[model samples]
Target chain A: MAIDAVIPFKPKNPKTRLSCVMEQEERETFARAMLADVIAASCEGGCSPRLLCTAPYLHPTAEVCVDADGLNESLNRVLSAASSPLLIIMGDLPLADGAAIRRLVSTEADMGIVPGRGGGTNAIFLRHPGRFRADYYGASFLKHMAIADEAGLSVEVIDSFRLHTDVDEKEDLVEVLIHGRGEARRCLQSLGFVLSVEGGRVGVERRTHKETL
Target chain B: MAIDAVIPFKPKNPKTRLSCVMEQEERETFARAMLADVIAASCEGGCSPRLLCTAPYLHPTAEVCVDADGLNESLNRVLSAASSPLLIIMGDLPLADGAAIRRLVSTEADMGIVPGRGGGTNAIFLRHPGRFRADYYGASFLKHMAIADEAGLSVEVIDSFRLHTDVDEKEDLVEVLIHGRGEARRCLQSLGFVLSVEGGRVGVERRTHKETL
Candidate 1:
């Protein structure tokens, strides 16, 4: 099935721990690369979801949402803009990659809603494919899930590591950096982050999936 | 405001993992110590609106559910067994401790539901006192939330690291052990269970909470 991947951009508070400390150049590089990774991962997983984008720097994305409306509006914009199956995402999310979206899209449910650990919808999909106005994604994930259930939509919350962690605070930056320490450890070294003994002692793990696509 | 903690016992697998690695005596010691930790911590937390009791160990918790019938049975047990506000807990949970329950019980809410990730409900409190018959546990957090909402009960999901990670698998074990590391690290440690990784390179920045208790 073809998908129109939607990323909603809601500005973050500078004081908000999740604000990006990376400069403009780094941010752009990260964004472009991240988008590319999502696209490539989707392709590898056999999902051909198109990108319906909205954010700080709109590139040659499928389309950039002009109004900086809140999350629901931005999500509805891209979801409404396309008639194809789609996965709506949080643009600020740096951890979610193609694999996560693939799993989410591949999930066999009438409506696939990826609820953030905190209250909010990280990524949502409509097997029916249309502009269904779901006014959620606020203070709570529980609230968001409740709204989905009331709409009579069949919802499934898939357990995916990448999908689970959305970079939202200063500490998130550290978490991701520490996770980078695989054979990719030098990547963190290059990025100028430190790995406390805590990082190694705590360790990291990812789940296995039945091959996607 | 008071807690009568109920631990529903349903063990999915044998205690082989904990028993196999450690000495037989050590395994028993570990279980007893763990139980003591829960009791002592609960006392220290000074939260339990009432009392904490364990259902006679019988079924695998995964088998014992919190659906309508199960919830009704548990609530009936709570009503008959407890004289104070009741907070329901699953006995299979090796990680949940007193500090977490205290936080759940002591926190002010007309009614409360401690949610587990991926549509599972951990613990719930009813202000009506000994009047709960809602079955919720395993994979039914959302259902219980709706039930509470329908009853016009104020429902809250308290943000506590100690409570969030439920041990259902090997990865969950890693996550449970890594709790109390703060929000960012807690989330990242969950990532580690799914894959092998190194020290640094990627960053998962969470907006740090001022963490007001």
Candidate 2:
């Protein structure tokens, strides 16, 4: 009955799409805050979380598994290492809460897959070690579902917006600004980010105030 | 020698995706303001502006062409009525400016197409009335380019961020708030929308304020 959660985090050179609006130092800081928030949610959901890392920055309490390979191999390695039910969650989900994570893990299916924003797999809960291979690239949710189906595994699709909204683009920053709480919000505010309305649209604005960090 | 710019304005039910955040009255007012902004930009670009409308709201000096048909048909009707070079601009481009429009029209190709955000046509400059049909639905920029190719018309793709950013989704409201100017900004400000950072994200928070209009 032990559930181990694997959170993949790319702390080095993170949130590049947000580079259009955020400076490099701030992007890294914001990414770490999001990772911390995701890890906190996983632990709060009664799961022992593991960090699969490429960079040196480590979450204080989570067990760190360093892997230099691509996302597929690193995740696969972590999945192989687990002795019980495994959960794979993306680090960028700032709005991930305990109830959502608990719901995902508590599902009765052999596997559960959650679709990410703009065609990616956000979260997957697998009961077996090698029931299906993890293909976490473009349009991955459908691919994961198909893999689970081919293996004749019962799959549960967890349709949760908070679990799906990964911080990927400048447009995505709005979701965080409008609905996000905790570390990510504090990081953005400290960076002097403000929401502005003009030209029939909304976006983040950092005034003459530069990042002191 | 003359360039007539046709801006299609759907003043009724402007941005439905933004219904998650903004009320109906605010969305309509915002859409009308964007239409006015587009008209001003078109006029400043040395193009005679015209509004092809389904509703009764009129831009002060621009010629109003009332149409009850669908988007594709209404646009085709306006195109057929024009004798000189015709320019088609979407009413939702709040960030559109005179420079972008001037660049679009000044292109020497038989057809000039500007790509919109989330895969739609933002602006089109056509020298021939029946050269290529406008397909402004779902990834229409590529569809337009293919159409122009089949018609043996030279297509010029004008790459401008301001012209490409169409205000359609709730996420798009962030762009307007961050980088917008004039009426749209003033309107949102009066609505008491403030950027709040929480739960590791940024979001809009209204504090003790209701829409005055």
Candidate 3:
């Protein structure tokens, strides 16, 4: 089975939700980092994906095909073209790791579901890639599972930290800062993400619930 | 007893993260709307927060002074002066419901931690008001809990969807679009975050695993 790595690049205006927290450059930087992560994972796997769909407007890169269609259309177009096993990843998932992707692709099951921490679908894979279509985000994890059941496809929910977090807002970035350690560390201190722990304590303590509540 | 409500107001900038997906003015407008959500929540509680901390400045209506200490320092000033109960709500936690706040406060726990589906604290209420001095974002959830323990105070993790899912990215906006049936329902749809799932599923569905792993 061929493992085709796909990152859904939604070039929607970054201002959509919690994205108001960082600058555009930072957001772009975040995307660049995610792409780097995908590249790194691909390198570890030592297998170049068959196709990569992104914005047609961006500069050409190795194995990346700029999908001229708008965000969702591009994703759907790529989803329709999968001839082998397909691994659909979110471009916003900075925490995605190579090991997780390899594990998911290596699975015996015909389908894969990786849930975002907030009940959204972070990453999904399918043996019959082109035929799979459903709501991309939101609480779509369970929905996809149900569809697989109806389709009679064996499904697997790969438990992974890398597949669980995707950054699209400021707080999501904060989550990266909090959870990412070592190389994957969000480099919060360098990125100027705020954290004020004085020797790991607030230092100010008082007791008064009756007074306020 | 002072209940200082900490909110971060984002200034209009082309560099802000939201700008990546939206125009600068659009980003600011979105940020303000989130601030309004907090303001509304505080109003429902019948107690105005002592301070409204914005990025690089404090609100004109606020008493505490925050001269751009970044998010960390601003929260520090408020937490330091919080001799009474302190309600620290994210500006983007639009789904945070008044009932959830009431329940959290009613518990009268030493540290009220409303963990986001992503594992971060969404709405945190300190009964001692000034007992927590740890960082605000990232892994600080677990870190702050440790801090409370070190300070000889109790810490309770309260699970509330309203308090946990703060909007920071586009996918979060999609979450609001999918599950906006709650308090922020109209607000979500009105903001142009519409994704017609066409009624398939709300979240991730299928799971494919490697047989070897």
Best-to-worst ranking by lDDT = 2, 3, 1
DockQ rank order: 3, 1, 2
Q: Give the Å shift of residue A139 in candidate 2.
A: 1.2
**How many residue pairs clash per model?**
53, 32, 45
lDDT per residue for candidate 3 within B17-40, as digits (tens), equals 444455676666666556666666
Candidate 3: docking tier: incorrect
Candidate 1 per-residue lDDT, tens place, B1-213, comes to 434455443222333454423445533433433333343445455534222223333222212223223445655666565566766664334445565676677657767766554445666766665444565533356567666677677766654434545543333443433232233223333333222223411212222234211
Q: Report the poorest 10 consecutive residues by lDDT, candidate 1 chain B.
A: B200-209
Candidates' interface RMSDs, in order?
Answer: 14.5, 14.0, 9.8
CA-based DockQ, model 3: 0.05
Cα lDDT of candidate 3 equals 0.59
Please name the candidate that would achieve the greatest TM-score relative to the true structure. 2
Model 3 per-residue lDDT at B4: 57
lDDT of 1 by residue, A1-213 (tens): 456565544322222332345554444444454454444545555555344333354455345545556556666565566666766665544445455577778888867766553434556777764535656533334555666677677777654435555555444444445322222233333445442234212222221232211
lDDT of each: 0.48, 0.76, 0.59
